[model samples]
Target: MSFREKMLWVAFIAMIGGFGFYFLTLLTPIGQNASPDYYLGLLFFIIGLTIGSMLVATLILFIRNRSEVTFKEDERDRNIHKAATQIAYYPLLLGVWGSGALFHNGVSTSIMLNILLAVLVGAESIRLGYQIFLYRQA
Candidate 1:
C-alpha cells in the first residue's frame, strides 16, 4: 500500500481506539461527572494517540520503503483532500452550534468540551474515511 494509504489506516484505527477509550472512561463515575480539565485531558490523549500513530506509521513506511517514500501530491490528491474536508465541515459546524446553544443555556464547560471533542474526532474520522475511499476508488 502507499504511504498515504497506510497513514489513513493508522488514523482510522486510532480514531476507533480513542472512541473506545472514551467510552471505557465514561463507565466510571468520575467520567460521568466530567470536569473541564478531564475533557481537555481526554482530548489531548486522543490527539496524541492519533498524531503519534501517524508519525510512527510514517517512520515505518519510510524505513520500509526509503527510496519509495514520497511527499508529493497531484491533482487527485488535492481534490480528494478538499472534498473530504468540505464533507466533514457541516457536521463539525452543527456540533459547534449545538455546543454554543448548550453553553447559552448554562450547560457545563465539560459538556461543551465533550461536544467539541466529538466534533473534532468525528470530522477527522470522516475526512480520513473519505480519503481512504477515494484512494481505493481505482
Candidate 2:
C-alpha cells in the first residue's frame, strides 16, 4: 500500500477505536453521580489512540520509503484531496450550524458537544476514505 493509503487506514482504525472507547465508557454504570475520572479517561484514550496511530504511521512510512520523503503529490492526488476536503467541509459546516440551531432550541450543552464531536469525526473519516478511493481510482 502507498504511504497515503496506510495513513488513511491508521486514521480509520484510530477513529473506530476512539468511538469504541467512548461508547464503553458511556455505558459503564456509575450509580447516581458519575465521577469526572470517567470523562477524563475517555479523553485520554482518544488522545492516546490518535497520537499512537499517527506515530506508527509516520514510522512505517519513514522506514518503508525513506528515499521518497521529499516526493510531492501529483496533480491527480491534489485534485482528489481537494474534492474530498470540499465534500468534508460541507458536512462540518452544516454540523456546526445544526448544533447552533439545537442550542437555540434549548438543547443541553453536553448533547451539543457530543453531536459536534461526532460530526467532526464522521466528516473527517469520510473525507479520508473518499480520498483514498479516489487515489485508488487514479
Candidate 3:
C-alpha cells in the first residue's frame, strides 16, 4: 500500500479504538455518576493514546517505506481526498444539527457533547474509509 494509505489506516484504527473505548465506558454505571474531572481525565487519556499511536505508526510506516514518504500527492490522490471530504461533510453537518435539536429538547450538556464528539469521529472514519476505498479501486 502507499504511505498515505497506510497512514490513513493507522489513523482510522486509532480513532475507532480510542473513541470506541470512551463510548463503551460511558455506557457503564460508573461513567454515569462520574464527576466532570473524571470525564476530563478520560478524554485526555484517550486523546493522548490515539495521537501517540498514530505518531508511532506513522514513524514505523515511514521507516518501512522511506521512498514513498517523500512522494507528493498527484491529481488522483487529491481528487480522492476532496471527494471523501465532501462526502463526510454531510454527516458532520447533520450531526451538529441533530446535537442542536437535542439541546433544544432539554438534553443534558454531557450527552450533547458526547454526541458531537461521536459525530466528529464518525465523519472522520467515513472520510478515511472512503479514501481507502477510492485508492484501492483506482
- Backbone atom clashes (below 3 Å) for every candidate: 0, 0, 0
lDDT of candidate 3 over 1-138, digit per residue (tens): 889999989988998899999988988999988987888799999999999999999999989999898899999899999999999999999999999998999998878888999999999999999999998999
**lDDT per residue, candidate 1, 34-111, as tens digits?**
765776678678778867877887788779877656668778878989989999999889988988998999987666
| CA deviation > 4 Å runs, candidate 3 | none
TM-score, one value per model: 0.83, 0.82, 0.96
Ranking by TM-score: 3, 1, 2
Better by TM-score, candidate 2 or 1: 1
**Top of the candidates by lDDT:** 3
Candidate 3, poorest ten consecutive residues by summed lDDT: 31-40
Worst 10 residues of 2 by lDDT: 30-39
The lDDT per prediction is: 0.80, 0.76, 0.92
Tell me the deviation in Å of residue 41 in model 1. Answer: 4.3
